[model samples]
Target chain A: MTAWLLPFLVPFIVMNAILGIVTYVTLLERKFAARMQSRIGPYRVGPHGLLQPIADAIKLMMKEDVVPTAADRPIYNLAPIVFVLPCMFIFATIPFAPGLGVADLNIGILFFLAVSAMEIVGLFMAGWGSNNKYAMLSAMRAVNQVISYDLPFIFSALTPVLLAGSLKLSDIAAAQAGLWFIFYPVIGQLAFIAFIVSTVASENRAPFDILEAESELVAGFRVEYSGMKFALIQLGEYAHVIGASFLGALLFLGAWAGPGPEWLGPVWFLITAMLIFLLVTWVRWSFVRIRVDQILALSWKALLPSTLLLLIATAIVVVWRGVPGV
Target chain B: MTIAAPRHVELDYTGSERLTMNMGPQHPSAHGVFRAILQLEGETVVGVDAVIGYLHRCHEKLAETLTYAQYPSIASKTDYVAAMTSEFAYVRAAEMIGKIEVPKRAQYLRVIAAELQRVASHLLWLGTWCLDMGGALGGGATIFLYCIREREMILDLFESLVGARLLYGFYQVGGVRYDLPAGWVDTCRQTVDVIDTRIDEYQRMLEDNPFFQVRTQGVGVISRELAQEVGIAGPLLRGSGVAFDIRRGEPYSSYEDFEFRVPVETSGDCFGRYKVRMAEFRESLTIVRQALDRLPDGPISSRPGLKSVAQTRIPKGEAYARVEGARGEVGCYLIADGSAKPYRMKWRGASFSNLAILPHIIPGHKVADVVAIMGSVDPVFGEVDR
Candidate 1:
């Protein structure tokens, strides 16, 4: 590691930062809820509950790692890892700033799509392997909701790629150097709206959170998990949300392209990511959850068609103009 | 009672893949220790069996062992959320059997206490119901917190009067145990005003919310004929356009002196019931204001000559007293055989009847609608299983 933050150490630094941010995201949610509900949030452990996440991690460690006797032990042991890896892995190809990331893979978006899809498998395993009826029901819902939302999510995300004429995240950001994609006329704005909706749905945030509705299935897929295993699942969930927010930032908001000095490029990226995360938190707290049928109906009926039309229009615009980025 | 199973929706898909999920004996949104076996065809609820009685306290039987004058404390436990109504019913039954004349001031005070109790119970119902709807007013827990904050102001007022916050056995057979204290009426008006403002805030938050409308409107609709056949009362009945309220029709206590309109809706759905309860909050406040304004200056208790509760003699026969409780009708039946203790007692808890209609309503809707419908029904387990 050098003074400039070495290339080899970038993965280590980013991974640690992502994990740290994941911990604080939970704190952010708690504080956000407290402020909305008119109560003082965590304030005992640290100054304004800054160290609450560390305390929570330690408390989870001290707790007994309970495995249900009837559970599929091997899969139960592996589920958290399977779920968490893809979430962290997606950060690898996410260019935080110009040349200030782990990898500049040409197929960064495709890699993100493939890796994120692996999360549902891990989620299903967490549900199925638990050998509980509620868990199974939740897993079935997760499969249905995730798969249905994925189409709209991809179609919406691909609009920027169509405009950029490249799969690389850095190139996409570079394409938006002149102007952020959100300001790219009516077409970009439409895709941005669709992209945000699909993002919430795909990430299984309420009101699309039929999988872990808590009131219905009692923590849903992770109904049987405990101790560090339970902690891992929660970590994976927040990380996945943050990862999705990062992707949203890059695709629509022009990641790291803020009014700042060159040295503060990655800092701008972090700020943008956090702002997007705050937006997600706002939505998660604001709306009631929709029924599973209604969620599917929304994706199929409204989001899918609108995003598809936007995608086609973006493609035509790219071909007609022969855009500079293309 | 074996109610007929509800008709399932005619889905085009074959029912090859089915799932059964047990909701709770300890679930948060169940209200209290309620279990429901939900039969599902992939999130579509095909059938439901509501299992209850986990909070059973043998309340009616326990009343037989206690002295006639001492039963009000026990009655408070039956519907702990709105303890004043249960206490009032028990004392009113005793007063009816003994031919006791309540003081003019005591009757007005009873009206005030009972109306306030209705407001408190309805506030609690609104909060928990929003919690069950999973983020209607705000998040699942946000509206609950806001409502609880408002409820705290009411509880504080009650605590100052009765020296107990939740289960206040503040009524005697003849009159109330305590009178309104100095500056209490003004404080009550102020609290009611704050509550009125908050009720408007909740309406602004939930009534016009598109998400709330989508989840609640036309969902869990109980037809007028079905609601009448099942004999629902209170807001559930009013929501179905039955237009029957015990307070309005029967005019118990000093209700005849206060004029307020009964809120009725024709939708007979969760949203309709929500609107009815919201209207009830305002009406309850109106009744409280009227009772306070017309409050007479007299002795708090008619039987102030009596030294202690145990010394009070009862020359009684069978008597029944029913009140318009928050849920519906809360009736207390006393069968006194010319003695200090009752031979038998029967409590007709409204929650039992309200909860009975669950199996009839849940089959055609999705599983999530169970939470909405159950919340709209507003069953208290303490009342249901007493």
Candidate 2:
């Protein structure tokens, strides 16, 4: 009876924990961005705005759910749930520590990459169902940009898999015990840089954030969404960012491998993930966004070819050194 | 206010459908209450129709009702970003037409106020232009906040000198309204010095940055011939290698006495205009420092203090006084009828003329370039609509 309930209970706990963390991650970003701009962010709420996210959550929940008269109601209502699910689903495969995860699938990194890419469908659905021109234009850009970057993102992620010689994420982490992939010679550094660039592009942050270019598209695909619908869309976006950060930590930084006892493994893993998240956030706030064409050009002309070369080189190095686990 | 009907134009090209998109009057990067109806072939803009007058407040008609004494304060409303320059043009017109002799001391005071106003206004333009290109939540906000921080110091200087920050009624027909308060010069000197160093910081932040360079460079190209033909003034003109500044050419309000270089860039693009403005920031500071050093002791106004609304009357004559405002050449044409109020007053708002060049240059660029071009143009709606 206890074994039967284990799978169900673990997922239920993880979902609730993610929902709570996603809300607070927003506050963390705001504070981080605020310091960069030399201003105090959210100071008026309960004790340095610790309760600000809670207040915001309550407000969003209590607010009216405004559906546009011209909207396709069913798709509009279903889009947020569809979008948030895949983002949260990616976390299930990301092991926080040894023996600590949801499924730990055999093809863990592949599953993570494939499932993470599914958020675009819900993004397009929200944009199409809104019945607004800005939303439609933004959705078009989103499709173009995300598809272009995914190749580079995948090729770069595969570099580490090539280095570790394993499809399983736990095996990849275990192989990093002797030396992290990021600390490996030439191929590792190049792949990590490529990974970060594609991650930023896929996440739709600045310098590549033409889809939601507020100066151009206002709120972009989510322009017509209001109340809790807007909150869910926002939650999904942060969850995706957090999910990517966790994956970056696992693949390159050696997830749960740190200077401490075994019990402190999860704590160190969280720290590494947060560090990766902050690095991406730093890039987001330090550059102006490029045009859609320019963004596409960067992905296809630059990132794609270089990442493919890097992937080929990684495979060569792995074969030359004798594959790690195999 | 009713929006004007969208203009229909014939497209020369066939195949792809043209999407007519309305940007602004309500858009985030509109800069003010400006609307542009853009006809696009995919992401490239093929044609543009600009709409103004949402901020129109009958400024010309109001000038007919108020006397010269009462009108200077209201003149500040025209280009509220550089209110001192706006007031200077109105009062200078009154002083010119009436042949009222302004003291040397008063002339120097006007120069100081105008130059300082130039610095303050450019800081605002720099901040908002970055905000327009960068988006409110991104790197643009970082620059915006830093620029505003420096601008606030200048506003504080104005507050101490004239008892107001923005829309100062500091200028009168003969000269300035208030003499520099005790220790105000020291404060002014300190402020400009601090701003001088901060300007370098801003340059370092954006000058070599590839992201900023791509957004601004070669985005908006206004040829020297087009700039002259369209009647655009100030940095927009100088940026195209015109080098025609009213301050240097006409030399009003003792601007001839100040030693400063009028920056000119022949690149004829958004980057050129940006370089011109950044250089102007330094030149304006130089003039401020010079004016502060040579400030003479005397009564501020040539005319006696205002005892009544109609006490100071202008003789029946016509004169157009133009000053180098923060945006461009701010000119006021006054036809006095030997009465307290003018028979006719016409304002040549710099932004009004500066904005006319948009439809000429905005075509064939992508949608992102529109905001970048508009930001480089830097039209304050108060001046444009008035």
Candidate 3:
């Protein structure tokens, strides 16, 4: 029985752990938003809204599933699955502790970026398949906004690689043990800043959340969505945000590199990821969304150029002070 | 108000298809049941067609059926946000027709109430308008909730006096119905002070946010000429550099006794409007403080006699009384036929005119700016549809 269950054990454990964290992250966002707005968030479900996510999950599950009659049934059915699975797959490459992840791919950084980008296809499928004008408009916006920021996001991620001389996340994290790439030099700080900005834009968060802007598009691509399908899409979004946050911690903040016993490595990693998530929430609650054109211009005109300069500078620095790993 | 919308001109399209997006009879930032058919060429609003009268209650017709003294109740309901200003306008018009002399202390009380109402209305606008702009402008609902929380204090002050909170038809033909409750002035003073301090916190949070600036600055610009042509009143007009405040320009309700600036801005944009309203809050606090300070000691109301609301005979005459409401000028025109009821009544609300500039300015801006600009105009649907 031990031999038979061994192969699925790590995947089962990590999947459940991620799902549990993502469920509570939504609660965290709501509570944080409520505090920012000067109101009690969700206090009725459990002590400090602890059981609110569970209640929400059940409510969503029980709700009658709805699909727009005009929608492409197959793609409409498939979109959330497409959106959610790839987001979950991103965790496969993320090394939580010394040996505490689902799988340790050699090309983890590349795989993470590639898998994360797959989220757009699902977003587009949902947008197009829904047969809604607002959804179509949202799809157009998500395409423009997400694709534009992808350049800077990828370019900025290369900065840590430049400093570490490795593409593997664990190797990259181990390299950050001495000093996280965020503090390496002038270019390192700028890259970190760029990466954070890109992450916010990439995840379709506020100050860049023109897609689901309630006042404008009125729920955007998720306009026609209801019940469990809606929940899945939301899950996919929060999952992506937290997943990217974890990747960010691993790349820049020295994953699990805090003090205490080596066995407490996973706890340290969780704390850092959570801190990053809190920072992201702080930004989301504090800023208003810019226009679609403004978002695109900011990425292409501002962030892309700065990140490219940082990349070139990092390359120059890497050669000037030749490290043996490359 | 009959808005003369520009003729819809089909743009010479090079290739792309034009999409007409229906944004609310139920949309979040519509204020009320206002629908705008937006013709968009990639988010730029080429043309906008407004659908109105969604919340029509036939207030003018309803006023005709009500008695002269009882009409203040209807007036209060018309401009729901700043009910005191509307109530004051109707009461003043009746007082003028009947030649009812208001007591000195009662006049001061009216001034104080009107100013407090303005503060309440403006606070609500500040919150909802910031909410309309979403998080990019004023950090979204933080400002909104804070504004509401403070506005509730002003409501509490009203509730203590009038026995009702929002729609208090507290004014009478001769003067105000109730005198100041014991220590009410001090409570009011403290409330305004709290609100004044809270306004500074909003300024720090939103007024200094660079992203907020980008979203608002130079976005929904209504030129001075266009504003005058549209006859937009209050902040919407004043934001375009027009100095036509009924309070300062043509003083009424002993407005000349107390001093306050009619805050104006030249840009005539969303940011300009926002700045004007922010400045107006401080100005309102000044007016409230001044009125309370100079509140003369006298008969809290007129001597119980001929000028009683229900029994008072309205003479055969026509009188129009206008006051600078929180939105703008709220004018009440009453023509009494020597009967208990008015012959014909016309309530001219500022929001009706303010809503007209929407189509003119909306053509060049994005769909999102529609919410921001509409919010900046601050049209209370009750006032507009009435």
Candidate 4:
């Protein structure tokens, strides 16, 4: 039994690292915004607000979780669990560090994509189950917007997979030893930009946050959610954001690959992950949000054509590189 | 009031597949207790029936009970955002009916106060509209804070002149309640001058921004013909390239004396309205600057003593006085009825005119366009549903 426990302990350590990273990601987002807007954020909780997320968690748990009387009892009760479960499941597949990720499956990219798509279902359930009109409207928009934008997102993501000649994320990371895709002059850089736009759109970030336009829909889908349920939903969204950055890093920026001793793969992976999260946070605060139709237009007309071209370009590159072997 | 049957307009109305959604009465973003019953054919709006009267405090009915002297206090509720303009229009209506002569100084003071109020109202609208467009991530709350900062300064000037902040009961039947406070003109002039410089910052933040432009440009288009038929006024009308500003066309309260241009936009969309308002902000500051430069020196009140005027009450007559409010043309129709109180006070709130255009323009657009349309129209339910 003791011999069997050693292998299982690895997953536990990796899981704890993910949880700690996500907690600190929230702290980093706040700190970045505060610096951008010229204010100090969350300095009083602990040394540089290291304990802020803990204090928030405690506060959320202590607050009254009021379920509206008119809400659908079963679905409303289940929505937060549904939202949080996918984020947890996603963590199981994402390659955090070399030999550190729980499952380094051959079809890692496909699995990640499949699991990530489940977030829409959770959002739909939460929105519809709230029994609120605004929530239902947001849910409807969310389904349409997410479904429409997914085409370009998936197509753009296909480019790197084609170039690397494998669906495994670890293999893709290893392929980018010399140069990340973003550094590849025009074609690769365009594909990378498309990935960023689609990733941000899919995660329901600003410019694609129609589901939660506070001034327009009055908190939109989450208007009825409160207390611990609301906190969990927010945590789930932050997790999605972190996951998106990871996806971007994996596909375009060359995940976990940095110059150092070969043994320092895991440490570099952690540092790279933190850098990606900060990049996303900076993007969120720096601009005004775009509307739904604009996003749709961008996805359908702009992103679709550009990504298709990039994918074709990558295919040609692969064939060119392979023909010399004969 | 005849109820018209629903129009048989051939729209993209797929009846069976559509989902009917109800928004508001409880929703915070509806802007002061309003509701819209929308029939959506998949995210595209097919039919929309606006239901108001939720915030209907029966202001007209409430006004019947209040005496003419007490009316100034209640008039502020009509358009709460720019309460000073409401006070000016109502008191001017009373004076028109009573056949009293206003002092030159009082008239000038009224113009200054009303113009300042317009700037304040426009500032609030610009801030909130950006928030509505940008959501939380666009630094919306920061714009809200900056707008309120300028508005607070204007309100302080109102307080110095009229002795109250939100509801200034300063306008009397014949003239104003008091003269301008010493050094008040300089403070107001300085505030206006400083605000003129900061207006560019707001434009840079929202106007030239690609995100803001993309979200607004070519969305929520209202044709010129439709605008006229629907009686859309102010920025909404002007956005469609119509030159129909009441201030310019029918100059009220020394407005003829000022040289200013009414900004117009060719595109009748959300972006057009936004551009017109941004230009109008600069125009409003221009008007305030002009008023302060030529501010006359004399009695600010037509009625010298309140007790002396109380002996000779307003005569039996009726009159209508209209003013260019922050939203559009705000009119007050008053009947004296030979008493201290008005017999009937009918208000033509700018929000009422602005809201009438929604039903005409709402069709053939997605549900998301509703917010853009509503924000462009700039209806305050405190006035619209009042």
lDDT of candidate 2 over A1-326, digit per residue (tens): 69999989999988888888888888888899999988889878799898999999999999998899999999999998898889899998988789888989989999999999999998999999999888888898989999999999999999989988888999999889988889888887898899999999998888788878888888889999989999989888999999999899999998899997998988888889889999998888777778787888889999999999888888888888887644
Q: Residue A277's C-alpha lDDT in candidate 1?
A: 83
lDDT of 2 at A210: 82
Please state what fraction of the native interface contacts candidate 4 reproduces: 0.51
Candidate with better DockQ, 3 vs 4: 3
Sorted into a CAPRI-style docking class, model 4 comes out as acceptable
Model 2, range B1-386, lDDT digits (tens) per residue?
A: 33223233345667567788889889999877999998887778888999999999999999999999899989999998899998999998999899998888889988888888999899999988888888887888888899999999999988998888998888888878888889989999999999999999889988878888988888889888788777889999999999999999998878888899999999989999999999999999999899999888888888889899899899999999999998899999999999999999999999999988888788878888999999999999999998
Q: Candidate 4, residue A119: CA error in Å? A: 1.9
Q: Write the per-residue lDDT of candidate 4 for residues B330-364, one digit (tens) a residue.
A: 88888878877778888888998888877777766
lDDT by residue (tens digit), candidate 3, A127-155: 89999988888988988988998889999
Q: After superposition, how far is residue B319 of candidate 3 from its true place, in Å?
A: 1.6
Instruction: Please give the interface root mean square deviation for model 4, in Å.
Output: 2.6
- By lDDT, the better pick of 3 and 4 is 3
Q: Report the lDDT of model 4 for residue A129.
A: 89
Q: Which parts of model 2 have CA positions greater than 4 angstroms off?
A: A324-326, B1-16
Off by over 4 Å in 1: A1-8, A324-326, B1-18, B135-138
For model 4 chain A, where is the 10-residue window of minimal lDDT? A317-326
Rank ordering of all candidates by TM-score, starting from the highest: 2, 3, 1, 4
Put down candidate 1 lDDT per residue, B1-386, tens digits, no spaces: 44445666656667676677788888867888889988888778877888988999988889888886788878999889999999988888888888889989999999899989999999899888878877432365677888999999999999999989998988888999888778899999999999999999889888777778888999988888888878788899999988999988998887888999999999989999999999999999998988888888998877855566566666758889999999999898988877778778899898988887888888878877888898999988898888
- Local distance difference test scores for all models: 0.86, 0.89, 0.86, 0.78
